[model samples]
Target: MTKRSRRTHSAGLKAKVALAALKGEKTLAELAQQYDVHPSQITAWKQQLVEHAADLFGGGK
Candidate 1:
């Protein structure tokens, strides 16, 4: 059997997912199911958001 390659999401998509998670509208598991991604991936995205939040305010696009 041939191994299937893993699919990768774009940076923008990851940012969107992280923003949704930060909004507190849903739990990490819920977000993960909604986005069809792993819970750990969502956690990592959220952590990155927390770490780089300052950059967002600094207008560093």
Candidate 2:
């Protein structure tokens, strides 16, 4: 039996992937394969980016 180890991604990497997703230039599956992350994770990151986009414009202090 083989066990999978947990992988940790840096904030910068997450942001990069999320931005790629936002660009809509590639499918989520393609992004996942290129980034070596799960599609679901990419989806979550995209959602987070969308939800927090206003924060970048002084919405949050």
Candidate 3:
């Protein structure tokens, strides 16, 4: 039998998934299913977004 390779997602994809979760339109389980990732992973990405959201605009021009 052939071995299955581990799946990996990029930062952009994680950010997109996190944004979708933040929208509150779907449950975590649904998001996980849609993205084909673990719910905990999505939760971590969402938390990271929340923690750094201000940084995106906080930089002084």
lDDT of 1: 0.91
lDDT of 2 by residue, 1-61 (tens): 9997998999899999999999999999999999999999999999999999889997696
TM-score against truth, every candidate: 0.77, 0.90, 0.83
TM-score of 1: 0.77
lDDT of 1 by residue, 1-61 (tens): 9996898999998999999988989999899899999989988988998999898799876
lDDT at position 20, candidate 2:
98
Cα RMSD to native, each candidate? 2.8, 1.3, 2.7
Error of 2 at 20 (Å): 0.3
Model 3, global lDDT: 0.94
In order, candidate lDDTs are: 0.91, 0.95, 0.94
Q: State the displacement of the C-alpha of residue 15, model 3, in Å, after optimal TM-score superposition.
A: 1.0
Candidate 2 TM-score over all chains jointly? 0.90
lDDT of model 1, residue 42? 88
lDDT: the better of candidates 1 and 3: 3
